[model samples]
Target: MLTPSKPFTRRCFPAINVKKGVVMVGNATTFYDGDQKQRNVTDLVEGAKKANVVLEARQVAMKIFEDYTVSWYWIIIGLVIAMLISLIFVVLLRFLAGIMIWVMIVLLIAVMGYGIFHCYMEYARLKGTAGSDVKLTEIGFQSDVRVYLHLRQTWLAFMIILCIMEVVIILLLIFLRKRILIAIALIKEASRAVGQVMCSLVFPLFTFLLLCLCIAYWAITAVFLSTSNEAVYKVFNETVCDYAGKTCDPETFNVTNVTRLCPDATCQFAFYGGETYYHKYLIVFQVYNFFMFLWLANFAIALGQVTLAGAFASYYWAFKKPDDMPAFPIFSSLGRALRYHTGSLAFGSLILAIVQLIRVMLEYLDHKLKGADNTFARFLLCCLKCCFWCLEKFIKFLNRNAYIMIAIYGTNFCTSARNAFFLLMRNIIRVAVLDKVTDFLLFLGKLLVVGCVGILAFFFFTQRIRIIQDTAPTLNYYWVPILTVVIGSYLIAHGFFSVYGMCVDTLFLCFCEDLERNDGSLERPYYMSPELSHILWKKDAELLKSSESQS
Candidate 1:
């Protein structure tokens, strides 16, 4: 019995339940049931690490794309393309000047002919429309009488005398070409020198004044914004609504009734039984309108000054002649100057006009929405108040930071004056020392290309890009890549041109400095050494001595 008990397997343990409903037939320790699903330890850890890596990669890619999109390379490439286009246009314009003069003559003749015909038709129409009792004068008779009367007037007589004097001066100029050319050259040289000095001194002062103006504008804006009286705010809000549409409760107005009164549509007086918060808002609006009007007027005046100054500068440069000036070169220079000045003024005027129109529209909205008995009168009064307010504020603002602007203006003026002086001196030396053809062509090429490119690039980047619609939800995701490429190309081109310009400036500066130091007087060379001495300083004294006699 004892042996039998020992041999017995001690009744097999009950089958253990394992995960996935499997039975464990052997060891009881091998099988167990748990609430959580089983998974490999290695797989769980690896999956978590992989997810983190993916998230990090996405963040890195986004940052990299943003960085590349805004790089300077794109800006430079855009500028170069603009310059090339501008140069071509300028050259074409210069070539067409002669043709333009002829075209103008033809246009003038046509205009005169049209004027005569218009007068005749008006006279005939008047006679036909007149009553039987009223006697109508003949067109030719009326025209003749008007002309005779004009001729008899004092101003007209003076104008005729002036015309005769101008004709006489022209005849003198043609007969005394050599003397005229010499006088012009001398005058141009003097003007260039004076301009250089003024630019160095006066230009800086002007820049300082401009900076003062900007500061004054900001200070005034801040003060206006701070005023407790809600008139300006009301006006601005109304204007914004009128132009942009009253789509939602404007955060600017802070009017709660917008939602309560007009639950479905925009909060207008018609929707609120004319008892809405709009009236209270209008009072604030009027005040704002007044200041905006003043700001616009000042902007217009500034624009006018810029335009007139540019025109005067262009005229001065255009009319001035050199002793050995080539006709084509002078013509080209004149054309380029005219085009640049005209384009600058046109662009500036357009921008200002748009701003003015916006201001006017805001003022108009304020007046209209308020239901003032006399809208026009209210508008005029608001305008006057705004002007007064702006003037006082501007003066105060300028007083606060006058010194800073003055310093900036002084520095700018000095730089300009130095440049002008250098240019004048260089030109004088060039005329006396260097061959005209080489210098003229070189100068023309630089001016035409650089000036044209800068202007064109400004236009294209600022304007053209705005028109392209990239059909993407986010700008950075799609357009950024395209922009990066364009900008990179532009930058490369710009860098090349900039390097060339730097070289030229360095050479010119070195030559001028050497001439000044040596007191070479009129015998100095117009250009500095061709070598890139600035890049690597080597024997300054030897370089100076070499350049001294050459100048």
Candidate 2:
């Protein structure tokens, strides 16, 4: 038998089998000339070229691996610093959220104000300089960005843009002052919740592990499924032959009548499209593998969300901070989510997975249709892709809130989704203004963490820090480690910040529910913190106070 075999993972070479007297292509080096069948001489050349390419790629991969190995400790150190910074940032939000938010707004205004000033100065300075008066529209586009920067019109345009941005930010701050206060309160409350349920910050690691497992399984299964097809052999002739396209068994191809009629004909391996029953269904198997991967990955994420939501909800619903909270809130919530709400999580994950899968299929179709000249079909595909993209985002948003509701109420997927949607709708103004504002603030927190860590990583890896110039590892590419640290830092920051985010969402929903279900009366005292209650429901609290005074 002339079947290809892999002797090792990275090293593959063709071998002649004297016992079978059959020539075979190795798996790694196989190259088809065109269509399916490979020509004898062309294939050898193509295979050698491909083999050289593979060898070069392997060498590059090895170099990267070596660089990573050498700098592994530095990477770990950078990542640990990132984690600590994230933790500190999250903890600080409890006390400094208001200060940070105000400072951010002020700084944004000042930065834009400075930008406007700088642009104006540049415009003034470049007023009479050579090429300074050139119109931007006259030049149109330039590969050299400096050319445009030399023009006064560019500075004028920049100044105008900065002015507009400055005005917009100032106007927004003026209009949304009260909402910002509410958002700050919510963020502080969320921080307090996260501080109490500290273990919630670590829960993302579990989810990350689960997702890794899902990804590994999917990749390995996909590889095996793709390679499961049996190779098909077809007749190839240097001269014209009627049976050239027909399939033949390589084992007995020599004794076949076509070979007898056409002496110059030979059998060669074509593509791996096999006709066996099992091979015929490989595409279905691959699709199933992809779907399951999506399901499991989403399930892992949903589990984390529900668990964090449950822990934070417990904190929110507790009247007296840790006194009314559970002994191990995170563990307790995890157990509850696993024991009672796995089905709900799975159900939500299933819906999300289906939507995601459909989006993937649409993307695949779009890619397949790129070469086609049908404008209508392409337009329809573009519309479908856009619609599905929006649909996926909506489902994700709905599912996130639904998981929060499920964590609080222990309800099924549909009931929780409905309740969460209606609750958000009822508080649509708050959701739009306060909640989104809080999210923006949290995003800024993440950006700050990532930026700080990324800058540190860049300096260290590039040997720009004189203090650690001798300590940093030498590398083939400094950007690799820098990028790794940046990306890792972001994930670390996102994980820690996600706890705050989930806490905010849980507390927000709890706050909304508390308003609807309770008054200031002793019988139905609100579970929300006094600060949050006073800030968000100031009018309601005032009315209640007057009513109480009248009584």
Candidate 3:
């Protein structure tokens, strides 16, 4: 009998057969192309890896493999030890997230319960129903009191609905919590480890950089304000204002009310959302607001992204081989990112800017073209704009992935993007599942954190306001503290969630490389992680069994 076979790793097998360095079992290039049963290249690459074969020839690829396979005996020992230690930390954080979720659920329930109590209180207070014929003046309470009562009714109804929505969302999270935890299990643990690196290394460096940026921005603003001819023009000239106006300056620099007030709808206010720079000096304010400040903000954001991406990628790199953990991985990664990938970040930002500019043009054209009489022309314009809009979003996503790849490989933007795109295409379904699951879990975590904070603020401030059983007299103003708590909680949650998201992206890229490059056959094997090993182990087993049965 004749049979076709594929590579599958077995611990007892040799890495290289004596006959040739390359092991040949069958025609490996040919793949069946049935839509119903077509196997993915990622699976095939993964299958080949199981048999301990190297398909890639890049030096960087081998470097990554060597990093995983270094000091084999000690590496295994280190992994065992690290697993024991990491398990404790993982459990602690996982417990925290779980406890937070339950707290949010309870808070939502409390809000609903409070609303129900208030509804009964209001109903009980109504002694005698007034007829529709009764005048407003006939009501016993003052107008202010009546108005407050009406507002109270509205608030109770809104709160009840909101609380119900919150409860349903929390319940849904509870239902899917298990799957969500499993999906992000490894990444979450890694994030806890990465936190140590960020705190020790990344945060200080970034904060310093941010301070420098502020100083530089201030200096630049000063220069522009002094030199941008629009800022300082002599308005006191008799030719300009019949009544001598000395340099139409405001109490503050480059800000003043328009001396020549036009009709009702024409001139703008000096401060606030000034529609136009009606005042000459206001041009400086407008330029700073629209152009220089916007660019500086974008630059800072791009810088932060590059720095963070590099640090997270470094953590992933260190994680690939735990035995060789660097003492200063964060600093190491940051230096490399600044030196090598700054250009890549700039390139990505440029792409983003161009896409955004195109979007702005489309929006402006949309307004201008809305009144056009030709139906077919309008339809064409709409289609063109929609296409560009989608393209803009795709470019943004592509640019982000490119930055990750650049962080990993120290490659240029275009090359990194191309490689990342191809890798994703090869594992499209797997990537989609991981991306969606990870995003959902992180998002749920954010909502849980914010909800808990909001409720805590509500409980604290409500008690302090001295509620005397008549809706707290100041319950209407409780939003101030709640809103503040929510904003602060959102910022905190975002900080935590972003680290996890970056780790997920970095780890995924590492896994893609792991599946392609490393074969876990006993003679020359280093597994990605025990969790990942366990995942791939079952697939390897099933393949081996099938191949044997066929033979």
Candidate 4:
């Protein structure tokens, strides 16, 4: 009944009882079949479908792995090209910050405009065609997404969305013109700081390695825990009986009282389970394993953030460009973060891990309830999931800035988080506009790198190019290598650009502090770049000049 390997045709026979005359045991006879078995048609069909799906998935996975093995060298080349492009982009930002920022904005607008035009053309072309006038609601949802493309409403909706986006973007640029200038200045300043500390760009690799180790440890422990259970056998029968689910020894079951009372009953293997204390609480151990994985992964990321923040903070607070900076700032920061702030990092990581664990639990609950019909329960689960998602994001944001503060002031996690929170709140306007704009620009840079590398990979893997089509390795599915290259390129680009982002965030926080704690006097001169100071505080330019001249 449980496996398809021992399939057999079912048979039935009537049984005679001494007191009850001819007993109706045909159903009972079908239960313990030495040669045949009975099963529900629906269940059998479902089992076959599931088996087919599993087989298909395994085949696809094997093919993808084979393709990856064959195309590993090409994927490496693409990722290396992505890395070089990312590095060159960051270097060029130092000289062309404003020009690049404007160019990115223009390109975004042009892309949206083209999308609108293309949608409109498609909508026009679909007009007067058979079945094009069908309403989406009438046809309902389709498994194939391309079916929707034949409807005119889809193109109309796309055109409307693109038009709205294009208009909103143009208006935002017009309103935030001055803030964009400040963002460009910040990007320029961040570029200079990154230029000073070149080693920071490679820090993410260390974090990635640490995270991989954590994953490996967790995966191994989980596998061992899962396989630690013993086989469990139970009494099963087609007819109602007293020993329907009681534990039994398969070897000794035939002589037991259960078989004596119920002639058709049989002892069958149910699942992997045990009565031992360790096996009883294996779930708790797995939960602990997952929680530790989250904690360690977050700790690795937190360490990297603190290390980068310390390096860039040194760059910001230095009175002289490179003279006052430490000779090995990145290494010095690394040492300090490890020596003093390990506990604080652990504390922050623990908080984040707890929230993430709760989110995971909520997701598990949601999955379990998918077959349930309780509307209120589903609604509550949806709300909880949404809330925990937002909470995780907020905690991550808070922890990032808090780590920056810890790197700068050597405070505990709670104290650093509090200080960082208030610091950003005090300059909420700048936080809202300049910080996000700079982050958006960095995101665009990563996208640009990913796009360039992804296009090249797509062409090469699909053998679209004539020059190397014959040389590229053939694959079962060409998109496997293409996807690998795209994802790897994006990660490499994100790692490089994140360093620049951290530099800008550290400098911005330091700039806010410089404004509050220092005046335009020799004793408390600002440590900000001249261009940024000019853009933010035009009236103080004369005072800054006087302070500089006197010094």
Cα TM-score per model: 0.22, 0.72, 0.56, 0.77
lDDT of 4 at 153: 97
**Error at 227, model 2, angstroms:** 3.2
| Candidate 3 Cα misplacement greater than 4 A, ranges | 1-181, 195-296, 319-321, 360-389, 461-478, 522-527, 535-551
Q: After superposition, how far is residue 165 of candidate 2 from its true place, in Å?
A: 9.1
Which lDDT tens digits does candidate 2 get at residues 307-333? 999999989888788899999999999
The candidate that wins on lDDT is 4
**What TM-score does candidate 1 get on C-alpha atoms?**
0.22
Q: Of the candidates numbered 2 and 3, which has the greater lDDT value?
A: 2
Whichever of 1 and 2 has more lDDT, that candidate is 2
Angstrom error at residue 191, model 3: 3.6
Model 4, 1-551: lDDT tens digits are: 24333222343332121124433334432222333345344554577779877877788778878988999999899889999988887778877888987876776676667668878998999999999999999998643355788899999998999798778878878976766777888888887888899888888899899999999999999888887888889999987688999899998998889988999899998888877879768989999999999999999999999999999999989988888999999999999999999999999999999999999999999999999999999999999999999999999999999999999899999999999999999988678767897887787677677767876787788788999989899887777778888899899989998998888889988988888899979999999878778876752354356557999
Task: Name the better of 1 and 3 by lDDT.
Answer: 3
Which predicted model would earn the best TM-score? 4
Q: Give the clashing residue pairs of candidate 4, or none.
A: none
Candidate 1 lDDT by residue in tens digits, 113-213: 44345444444444444342232332233212223322223233444554564455346435543333332232223233223222221222343355467
Give one digit per residue, the lDDT tens place, for model 3 in 1-551. 11123333543332222134455335444333222233433455566665443333344355444534432343333334333332333344544644443444455456556655656565455435444234444554431223444433444565577667767766766775544444555454455456556443225346446646765776777665545444333343323233344343434422334444311112212223223344466554744444443344445555565556666655555545544556676667667877777777776776676666666667778799888898997788789888888997898678777777887777898998999899999877456555666666666656655655555455554555345334332333344444655665565566556656666776777667667766767764644667556744454455457658999
